[model samples]
Target: MKNVKARYLFLAATGIAMVACREPATGKEHPPSHHAASITPAKAHNVALYQFAGTPPAMAALIQKGIMTKLKVAVQLMQGQPLPAMSFYKPRNRYIADSLLVYLRGQRPAACEKIIGLTTRDISTRKGEIENWGVLGLGSCPGTACVISSFRGGKGKVSESIFNRRMITLALHELGHTYGLPHCPDPVCLMIDAKGKMNLDEGESYCAKCKNKLLAQGVVTK
Candidate 1:
């Protein structure tokens, strides 16, 4: 009787341990390694950028550099009019990308025509002629166009290792949506959704197939 009782107790302990170690059904319990593709980059007339006053200067600079670099490359590939100059604005408070657009329409109607607001809000809109892109800091978008926000530490906290590899890729990805590009099938491409948790190094600058698509859309020429 003692041996049988001991065996039963051991089995019960093993069952408890298994249950404790089991993975969560909801997936949010663990960090995600991959993100789906949300949007693609094409071409546009002008892209107006809005940043909150609290945003670090370094982050603003990174956004400008990454966006311009990609735009330049897209221009080289396509024959659309050169991207209009990008400008920055200071808002009263952190605004959602869509809300910013509406506010700009009331405040600066002319400026709003070319404006694109960047925020950390979790956005669910698709990319198109009139749609704006949002990129939340370190988050993913279920659909095209996300609201991207910065990490809490400020620009200084974003190291080159983080910016070049992660932030820049995200900028390019969101910008792609503005130009009417859809998510890419390639998991490692910058156009991939990445669910906002991708390692920057895992993205591609531009794939040939994507390039061709841009050309077809009149976003690129050659």
Candidate 2:
């Protein structure tokens, strides 16, 4: 268990999915390479954690602690809110991570650098253009918001610590997107393509190159 600094690792679909999307894992999403990694420090960022209707209080508390301890940024626990009565849910009953992201951005709090919506319900996003994939989460480059689902992580018979690590990994990966970090070339980095919820368990928080990118983008301190 290395304290990965971050790249995304693709899943091989080898084992039983505790909660998985329908999309196949592809390991080719990252950029070619960054010859000169930026070390120019940007100003500090403010991250807001929002709890959806079904988020478990105990789990949310642990995630908040992990964000503050690991990322070292200003982490604020915002007031709990409910999803608007809309079509964010698909036929499979999983919520749409992209739809939630749109809502969060349109109504983002003032001065919030980035915001992550955590929920107990399962979430998914688009795979190609119209097809849906049962993703653990999703976000955008230099975007204002992202969403993560704990229901997928809590599906299996795992310990509390492993579950917490999964949430933290998902959090940092989406946060990386907000800093404009693409997937990393490092096979074992946190920035690698996340295929399934279990895909996150295999990589370090960040690989050397991805860590540099996070540093360059000011997501991680040098």
Candidate 3:
């Protein structure tokens, strides 16, 4: 009798441990997992590109091409839109990236699965203790909207080609965030965090691990 009781208790404890391992606590900022994806109905992935007034048409086309080829997602180029004056931060002389995302989300067309706003204006978002912290771009994890800016890429008199490449890098990074990918540890991965340093030149492509994660989520093709 004593041996049976001990065995039962051990089994119960083991089962509890397994259950705990299977279900992590969910939160607003939690990255989506395969378990979450399983419950949601699968849908085709499509991206929409929006060129804000003042951004060059050539630059937007470059970014659109990158998304289409690398991400394997259909993209639609929307009509040019004016930048919202309310998003401008006079003190920083930059636009608020968070506000731009909200605007993009609201403006997102029904046919598009995700929307990205492109601009040449400097953009900023709150980071930790700093208000109006400048960033190359910003996006919501596992969300439908993102925004990128080329103002920082043109700095330091970089060659136009290099500057354009940086913009493409920024666009890819922000879009990766929208696909629920966090900063990758691989130094050369496109998803690597800028960490306020703007080292776009270092990123070549998504690391294998990051790409596999996207593959599992069906965001990237094999």
TM values, all candidates: 0.48, 0.75, 0.78
Q: List model 1 lDDT by residue over 151-199, tens digit each.
A: 4223466675665456666666655654444567786667765443444
Worst ten-residue run, lDDT, model 1? 14-23
How does residue 63 of candidate 1 score in lDDT?
68
The candidate, 2 or 3, that scores higher on lDDT is 3
lDDT of each: 0.41, 0.67, 0.75
- Candidate 3 lDDT tens digits, 86-176: 8889998999887787788788777666789999888988766787788888886656778998877865599877887888888888887
Residue 104 of model 2: what lDDT? 72
Structure candidate 3, residue pairs in collision = none
Worst 10-residue lDDT window for candidate 2 reads 1-10
